[model samples]
Target: MPENILVIGGGPAGLHAANELAELGVSVSLVERDAFIGGNPKKFKYKFLFPDLQPAENVIGELIKKAESNKNIRIYYSSEVTDFKENGKKFDVTIKSPKGTETKTFNSVIVATGFEHFDPATDSKYSYQLFDDVIDIKDLEKMMGEGNFNRPSNGKPPRNVAIILCVGSRDRHVGNQYCSRVCCTVSVKQAIELKEHFPEMEVYIFYMDIRTYGFYEDLYWKAMEEHDVQIVKGRVAEITSGPDNTVICKGEDTLLRGPFEIPFDMVVLASGMEGGPQSPEMSKKLGIELDEHGFLKPANITLSPFKSNKDGIFLAGACTGPKAIVDAIVEGGAAAMNAYIYAKKNAQ
Candidate 1:
C-alpha cells in the first residue's frame, strides 16, 4: 500500500501539500472544516494588483478542480480532525464529519489550519459592542457582498469613514506582539475599493505604519494617489457614538504629535489576524508546539519554511504565521516538497 499522508485544513497549504505528495505516489487525504477549499482567500471578491489582479474565486477554483482530479488524492470537505495519537513513527487521526466520525492511520501529518480574525472587543474604548455603527473590516467586506455600503444605523452612504489599523496586532498590551503581515495591505485594498464605490466620500486610514513591502508598494501608491485615500499615521485611542449616530474617533497623530478627533458616519476596525482559536486545542491533541503568540512554531525560517520541530509533521499557511494569498500559496508548495522528500527517504 502507498504511504498514507494526512493533511489537515483544506486551505492553500494543505491542498498544495497533498498535491505534491500525490505526485510522488503517496496516498494523501485532505480534511477541511469548511465545505470550500480556499479558506480566507475565498472570502475576498476583489483582485490584488501586485501579482496580477485576479478574482480570488478564479484562482482558488482552478486549484480545487486540479486537486479533485488527482488520482492519489482524496478530499473530505466539512470535516475536522478531532483527535490525533502519535505513535513514535505514525499518527492515528480521528476525524469528525457531519455524517459520522472516522479514524485513520497515516505515516505523516500536516497541520495547515489557518488564522482567524482579531476581535474588535479587545479594546473596550473602541465601543464596538455598544455602538451599532461600528463594523470590522471583514464585516464590511461581507456587507459589500450584500450590495450596500450604507451605515447600519442610517440608510445613507457614509460621508466620512474612518478605519483604524493595528488593533490587537503589534500591541504588547494585547499580547499579540507579532505583525499580522496582511492587515496593512488588506486595509489599503479595502480603502481603494471604497473610494471606487464612492469617489467623493472622505476616507481616512489611521495606521501606526504603512507596510507595503515588495511589489505591493505599487498598490499602496495607487490607493494614495489614484484613489485619494487619506493615510494618517496615528494610533487610535477610542471610538464613541455621537448623538447623530455618527462615530467619533479619538487618536493622537504620531507624526504631528497632537491629539485629533475625527467624526465619521461609520467606523471600520481593520482588525488583526491571529492563529485560529482552536489552534491551541489542535496543537495539544497533535503534540505540536505553539509559538508565544499561539501560532504553530516553525522549525526554522532560514532553512525550512513549512517544517515543525516534530518529525514527520509539517505546518503551512496562516497556522505557521500570517500571510497573504500569494505568500500562503508559495508556502503551501514548499510544504508539499518537504513532505514529498520525507516520504521518499523513509520509504519501505
Candidate 2:
C-alpha cells in the first residue's frame, strides 16, 4: 500500500506540502475549511505580495494548480477533521464534508491551518466599520485587487490618507503582546502602491517605529525617497468623525512631544494577525500543545519547527506562528519532507 499522508489545510503551506508529497509517490489527502484552497491571500484577494511585490496570483495560483493536477493528491473542500484518533503507528481520521463524513487511516498528518487577520473593531478605538472611510489592510488589498481606488465613503479620490500601524498587535491592553511580523512590511508595501496609484495624494504613515527588517528596508526607503511618502513618528490614539465626511486621527506626536489631531480623507489601519479559534480546536483534536501566544507549539521551535510533539503528526506555516507568505511556503516544504520520512518508515 502507498504511504497515505493527511494535510489539514489548503493554504500556501498545505498546498506546497501536498504537491511535494504527491511527487514523492505518497497519497496525499488535503482538507480545507473553506470552499476554496488558496487561504487568506485568496480569501482577501491580495493583489501583490511584499518584498519583491510580485503578483499574488503568480504564487498562490501556481500552488493551487500544481496540487489539483497531481494524481496522487485528493482535495476535500469545505471540510474539516471532525475526529482524530491514534491507531498504533498510523492514525484514524474522520473528515466531514458537504458530501458526507468519511474515515481514513493515514501514516502521518501535517497541520498547516493559517492565521486570521486581527479585527480592528474589537479594540473600539480605531473605529473600524463605524466609519466608511476607515478600513484595514486586508480590506484595502481586496479593493486594490478589484482595481477600485476610490474612497469607500464616497466615490472620489482621497486627498490625504493616514495609514495607522499596530492596530491590534503589540498592545498588552488588547491581550496580544506579540508583534504581527508582516504588518510593518505590508503597510509599507501598500503605501508605495497608493503613491504609485495617486501620485498627488498625500500618504502619511503614523508609526511608533518603522520595522521593515533586512532586505525589506529597500521598499521602505523607496516609498519615502522615490515616492515622497511621509512618515509620522506617532501612534493614533483615537479616531473620530471629521468635517466634510473625513476621519480625524487624534494622538501625540512622540517625536515632537506634542498632541495633534489631524483629519484625512481616509484612514487605513494596519491590523495584525491572530491564531483564531482553530488553534485550540486543532490542539484538542490532535492532542498537541499550544504556545503562550496562542499558536501551535512545535516539538522544538529552533531544531524542528515542522515536527509536532506527537510522533506521527507534523506542523507548518502560520499555524505555528505569524509568518510571511514566503516563510510559510518554505515551512510547508520542510514539513512535507519530515512527514514523508515518518510515513515511509512507519508505513503499515
Candidate 3:
C-alpha cells in the first residue's frame, strides 16, 4: 500500500499541506474542527489582507477549492480526532464528525490547529462590548467585508478614529507578554484602509511601538507618507464614553511624556492572538508539547519548528505561534515536505 498521511485543522496551513501531499500520490486524510475548510479567515469574513490590500477570497477561497478538488484527499468537516494511539511506526486515529466515527491508520500527522483572536471582552478597560463604537481590528475587518465602514453606534461616517495597538498583547496586565507578530502590520493596514474609505476623516494610531517588520515596514511608510496616517507613541490606559457620543482614550505619550485623554468618533483596538483552548486540548490528546503561551511547542524552535516533539507528528501555521496568512501557508508547505519525507522513508 502507498504511504498515507493525516492533516489536522483545515485552515490555510492544513489545506495547503493536504493538497501538496495528495499531489505526491499519497492518500491524505484532512480533519477540521469547524464545519467549513477556510478556517478563521473565512469564518471571520475578512474582506482584504495586509501588505497589499488583496481580497481575502483570492487567498483562502483558492485553498478551499484546491483541497476539495484533490482526488486523493478525504476531508472530514466539523470533526476532530477523538482518539490517537501510536501503533508501531504508524498511528491509529479515530475521527468523529457529523457523518459519525471512523478510524484510520496513517504514517505521519501534521497539526495546524491555528489560533483564536484575543477577545477584547476579557479586558474590560477597552470598553469593547460595552460600547458598540469601541471595536477591534477583526471587528473592523468583518465590517469592511460587509461594506460597512460607518460608525457602529450612530451608523454615520466617523469624523475621527483612533486605532490602538497592542491591546491584549505585549502587556503584563493582560498576561500576554510576547508580541503577537501580526497585529502591528495588520493595524497599519487597517489604518490605511480606513483613511482611504473616508478621506476627510482623521486617523491616528496609538502604539508603544510600531513593529511592521521586514517588507511589512513598507506598508507603515505608505500609510504615513501616502495616506497621511498619523502614529502616536503611547499606550491607552483606559477607554470611557465621552460627551457628544464619542469614546475617550486616556493615554500617556511616551515620546513627549504627557498624559492626554483624546476623544474620537470610533476606537479600534488591535487585539493580539491566543492559542485558545484547542492548543492545550491537542497537546493532551496528541501527546505533544504545548508552550506557556498556549501554542504547540516545536521539537526545536530554531532548527525544526515544523517537527513536533513526537516522532510521527509535525507542526505548522499559527498553531505554533502568531503569524501572517502568508507565513502560515508557507509553513504549511514546509511541514508537508517534512511529513512526506518521513512517511516515504517509513513506507517500507
Candidate 4:
C-alpha cells in the first residue's frame, strides 16, 4: 500500500501541502474544521492582498481548485481530528465528521492550522463594538470584498477615515506582545484601495511605528506619495462619541508631544493576530509545545521551523506564527517535502 499522510488544515498552507504530497503519489487526507475549503481569508471574504492588490481569489481560490482536483487527496470538510495517538513511527488519527468517526493511520501528519485575527472589542479602548462607525481591518476587508465600503452608521461614503495601527498587537495590557507581521502592510494596502475608490475622501493612519518591512515598504511609500494617504505619529488612547455623527479619537501626538482629539467619519482598527484557542487545543490533543506567544512551538525555530515537537508530526503557516499568505505557501511546500521524506523513510 502507498504511504498515507494526514494534513490538518484547509487554509493556504494545508491546501498547498496536501497538493504537493499528492503530486508525489502520497495518499492525503485533507481535513478542515470549517465547512468550506478556504480558511479565514475565504471565510472572511478578503477582497485584495497586500503589495500587489491582487484578488485574494487569485491565490486561495486557485489552491482550493488544485486540492479538490487531485485524485490522491481526499477532502474532509466540516471535520476535525478528535483523537490522535502514536503508532510506532506512524500516527492513528480519529476524524469526526457528519457521517461518522473514522480512524486512519498515517505515516506522517502536518498541522497547518492558521491564526485568528485579534478582536479589537476585547481591548475596549477603541470602542470597537460601542461605536457604530468603529470597525476593524478584517471587518473592512469583508466590507470591501462585498462591495460595501461605507459608513456603518448610515451606509454613506465616509468623508474622512482614521486607520489606527497596533490595536490588539504589541500591547502588554492586552497580553499579546508580538507584531502581527502583516497588519501594517494590509492597512496600507486598504488605504491605497480606499483612496483609489474615493479620491476626495481623506485617509489618515495613526501609528506609533509604520512597520511595512522589506519589500512591503514600497506599498507604504506608494500610499503616501501616490495616494496621498497621511501617516500620523501617534497612538489613539481612547475613542468616544462625537457630535455630527462622528467618533472622536483622543490621543497624544508623540512626535509633537501634543494632545489632540480628532473626529472622523469612520474609524478602522488595524487589529493584530492571535493564536486563538485552536493552537492550544491542537497542542493538547497532539502533545506538542506552545511558544510563549501562544503559537505552536516548532522543534527548532531556526533549523526545523516546520517540524513539531513530535517526530512524525510537522507544522506550517500561522500555526507556528503570524505570516503572510506567500510565506505560508512557501512553508507549506517545505513542510510537504519534509513530511514526505519522513513517510518514505518509515514506510512498511
lDDT of 1 by residue, 145-210 (tens): 566788878779888888888877898887799888777777777787788889999989998888
lDDT tens per residue, model 3, 1-348: 778899999999999999999989999999998889999999999888877889999999999999999889999999999999998888999999999999899999999999999999999889899998999988999999998999999899999999999988987877889899899998889888888899888999998888999999999999999999989998898999898999999989998999989999999999999998999999999999999888999999999999999988999999999999998999999999999999988877
lDDT of 1 at 64: 74
Query: Against the true structure, what is each candidate's TM-score?
Result: 0.92, 0.99, 0.98, 0.99
- What is the per-residue lDDT of model 4 for residues 237-314, given as tens digits with 9 covering 90 to 100? 999988899999989999899998999999999999899899999999999999999999999999999999999899
TM-score of 2: 0.99
RMSD of each: 2.1, 0.8, 0.9, 0.7
Better of 1 and 3 by lDDT: 3
Q: Sort all candidates by TM-score, best to worst.
A: 4, 2, 3, 1
Name the 10 consecutive residues with the lowest summed lDDT in model 3. Answer: 167-176
Look at candidate 1 and tell me the lDDT of residue 300: 90
Displacement of residue 3 (Cα, Å) in model 2 is 0.4
lDDT of each: 0.79, 0.94, 0.92, 0.94
Model 4 stretches with alpha carbons more than 4 Å out:
none
Compared with the true structure, the alpha-carbon lDDT of candidate 4 equals 0.94
